[model samples]
Target: MYRSAIFLKISLFFILLILPGTVACYAQSYKIDSLSLLLKSHPKQDDKRAELLLLLATEGMKFDPKQGLPHADEVLSFQNAIKNKNYVASAHRTKAGIFLYLSRFPESLESYNRAITVDKILKNEVGIGAALGNIGIVYMTQGKFPEALKYFLQALKKQEELKNELYVGIMLTNAGIVYTEMGDYKEAMSHYQRALSVFKKYKHFVGQANTLGNIGIVHSKMNNLDEAIKYSKLAIQIGDSIGNTRISARENGNLSGYYSKQRQPDQALKYGSIAIQKNEKINNIKSLGFNYQNFSDAYYQKKNYALSKSYALNALKIGQEVNVTDLKRDASLGLSEVYTALNMPDSAFRYYKMYKEYGDSISNDQKKNEITRMGMQYEFDKTEAVYREKQILAEGQLKQQQLQLALNRAELQRGLQQTALQKALLENEKLVSEEKQKQLIISQNNEKLQSNKLNLLSQQQRFDQLEIRQLWLYGILAIVSLLTVLIYLLNLSRIRKLKFASTLQLREAEQNNLKLEHQYQLSESELRAIRSQMNPHFIFNVLNSIESYIMDNDKRTASRLVQKFASLSRLILENSIKSLIPADKEWKALRLYTELEAMRYNNSFTYSFEHAPEISLSTILLPPMLIQPLIENAILHGIIGQAITDAHISVTMVQSEQTLIIKVSDNGIGLNRTSNKTLVNVVKEKSIGLKSIRERIKLLNLQYPGSASFSVDEGPEQRGTIAVISLPVLGVGSGEI
Candidate 1:
């Protein structure tokens, strides 16, 4: 929780810092002020004036992204006088950037499209490549990875054709990020390596550092912490040597993260402090956010939660100010962790919920396979555009809904005002009638009642404890008395047996006694075998899962699983040795066992049991603890990872011709999934419980020919498993079919 809080805080800090920092790095307010002064002094509707207008807009945007929107619009108006398609395209591109930074995605795309159209008409390959790259970046911000990658690849091809070395390296790096996001680590590394080579060959120190930083990120995701640290240090060294403050600051944060992950709090703090100092020097607000987040991580590792919380808050504030989803999501998550470390649950919940909302925006269903088809190729045809169009239309509809919601809130506010006025009148009436004073007196009496209730509970607890002690004493006395009575009865029986018969009669009785004792020994052995039905493997797996939950600090899930497992185990042990149990008791054990497995596997399938129409659960009998292993097999191999929505299992029992038929059926992947295994391996790995059941079936058949049978086969649709067993009905004591 503490670590997550730190990351979330840092992300937000970057967003807020970057919000006012992007254009400011290139042109301070003084440049914009001079441009504005020039514009005011020279007012002429011509080419020179249009240039002046664009210059002012571009300069003014340093302080605020929207500051140049009107100026750029005026520049576009002078296209007739300018007579240069290149200049017009440049104006559209400039306008698009402002909208992009403002998160006006639709406007940005439309402007970029206009620029592309002009570039295409004029055969401006460089402009086309640049616009395409920008478009891809916009798609990336929206989490449309496939669409982003498509454009980036196209831009890379064009840049290479044009011999634009810098853009080629940038495009390769962008593609690497898309691959990384898609979880293709090997492919991502390949792209990063190529990009790094290109940057090094061209002597682009900053680009080389950036690619190295990306490689470090992939290594981090793959859990190669040492490799991550190695690459990060190399990146930082390059950036520092070249005096690239921005790259240096970002790499320091990366180094700090690796050190924190390694549990080296001192080393992490050292790098984090360096990053923060460097960011402050450059007035890089976004970098400070990243740096502060590293501080949060270091402090959390040191167990200094107060400082961690402070840094996390700063990161979150910056993220919100910058209006970046990544920043906001991470900031909220980090903040949540910080609050959790502080033992503040409410605050933790609030930030965690915020994190979930932002995360969903990036990882929702549409971004799955559907993302792969978005804006295929560089050309925007009707068929290829359906996905992007739908996304844009949906976003627009959501915006309208938000606007309507604001209006609804205004109406609600008015209603609340009216309700408050009515309540005020009621309060005045209450004051006149002394009702308020009566209510206060009643509240005081309730408080006194609460205290009395506590006292009563304490007294009741004492009485219960005394009664429990008396019951224990009585139980011990009863056991002692019963043991004495049993000894006396045994002595009397022995005396009765002392009266022996004639020699021949005694021999005959002795033979009969030997037969009965041999039978008793066989029954005891069978019962012990029944006790062996509990699978050690299954029990061990359950224990392991419980241990994992505890290790993860998931107390709630661990406690719940442990309780269910304990109850199910108690039931199984109690019933396993019984010759016959009530049908409902066996059915309940099966249900509980299935529920435990289902919970362990995330409830990937549904289950049910069906009893014959005329069957009475109370009257019918079933062998105890005999059906659970069959269901467990179905859960593990049949449908454990199946994705179909209708996957399920059904157990049915019916009586026919004095024979009880039981069938366990499952709509699952079936046995073919294990076709690759040898037959011997399959049987051993598939269901050890079934092997035990086969032995029990053999023992049952020895009593009467064809009295019991079992078989496994394909279900109705040949897409699942069906196991059937037949047992002859018997009278409890007589044991007659």
Candidate 2:
């Protein structure tokens, strides 16, 4: 009865002291409801909406912690949708608080870290400091004192840079709490004293109260009972003055522990019950469980075993609900002590065994956390190394690109110089052609003059003959007349013979000049044909195929194709200037060309090369780039054009005594089956390569009768085309064949 009276007096005193703060809390609740209504009415997405959401989250946390989570999530969603990073950081920080309240430490840390990252991007120092402090709190909850201390000090430094006394005080108190938990009372007291000074300087009552409560915990740990009591009472008075149940609950719990150690059971019970009520009202399950265990100990000290057992059970239930290992450990110890006091050995033993089991579990969990931390550190180092390597590679690539650009500029300049040189050559050729035309006109004029002179001579000869005839008749001498007639006839016959020989010589010279002009045109056409073999479009397509192979990681195939391309290029460059090349050399170049084409088309067709065994390749002579163009036409116009899936080409050489028959056949669409008239016309008209070869054959035939002839027709199956060329066996000029 005396204990009940004392508890009643203490409860009444606390109620009176907290009455004003309670009314203020009621007004705050009204503001929260008004904000909720305002948020619902506002349809516009703006900063106003973000502000209202934040307010709702902060106010909702006072009564229903879980209620704040949705509001915080909405804030994050709204900020993210608007692409406002600064506000997003705020929203994340809010969510971290809600997660922490829900006892989700990992989620809390994740959210706080995300907020810090955003703030860093924005260069918002204040936001970063706050997030760091919150992260420290999460680490502290997980019993990572060193990590918690590190972050708290970092946040304090940032706060100091900003000269934000409130946050500085709050972070210092947080750090002090971590030190106290680690049992370093001296270091903890030093931080608390510095924080107390900062809070006092700023006149921030909440920061002051929080720091005071932390200081009390440190004092209690050091067994300084008087100083601990003084700090605890001062913190509780500050909390009651502000109507903050969270602070009051935390301070009162501290006071209850102080009183329990002083062996004042009634006073400890009084304060512990009040703390439990406040924590329960605010949904602070963690603090409520601790207060309950403290109440159980008070009851045990007072020899009230039944009540102690009851309170211990209550504490155990709350610890289980919250899943706080520290709460569970404390509850188990209290229950064991209570059961022992009640003389229930079995029950005591059971709880003592549970306490040891929880202790071991906590130790294992700490070890696992240590390993996880180490792994995270290693991964962070690895990621940093990779980032540095990528950065260096990017810089090197930039330098290489610059060098390539310079080279390209130099190449472009040289090409311009070459174009200028070509222009100059064209001008010189124009001058030469004009001079030749003038010379031709002069030669024609001279021939006209000579014809006129010849006409005059003939007229004179006619007159002289008439004169001689008259003289012979008048002088009466038959012999003289006959002799004169004979001489006239002889002179006339000699003149006619001389004119015939001169005309024959002039005709031969004109024929020789025409032949020379035709030969020059043929040489120019052959150069064009060799260039056309590696046309821009075909080269581009091949390059694209090489790129695809490289991107596909088929480097072996790409390398082989590149080498073949180089070989083909070398052959074209070397043979383009020559009129004729050995049959074997030409065949090798053809093979390389075909192989590259096949690889470009992903091996779409197969080809074979065969020759008569009786013929010697090295001893045979053929026009350079003669057969390749025919094979290309068969592939591009026949197989590729018709999209033949099972296409084949065969090149065969047959020796027939004096003529070498070279045949190229493909199992592709025949001439009659070709549907694109335009393409067919293009193939025929633009086949300068084939035309050039035909001209060369004509020239060869002129030199060596029946040297070359070509024809094309449908293949044996009527499903493909074949090109046949017959060239005389003019063996390598040595008659080796």
Q: What lDDT does each candidate get?
A: 0.73, 0.76
Worst 10 residues of 2 by lDDT: 5-14
Model 2 agreement with the true structure over 523-588: per-residue lDDT tens digits: 776676776677766677788888888999999988887888888889888888777778888899
Backbone clash count for every predicted candidate, in the order shown: 12, 0
Backbone-clash count (model 2): 0
**Residue 565: error of model 2 in Å?**
99
Deviation of model 2 at 276, angstroms: 1.4
**What is the Cα-based lDDT of residue 124 in candidate 1?**
82
Worst 10 residues of 1 by lDDT: 8-17
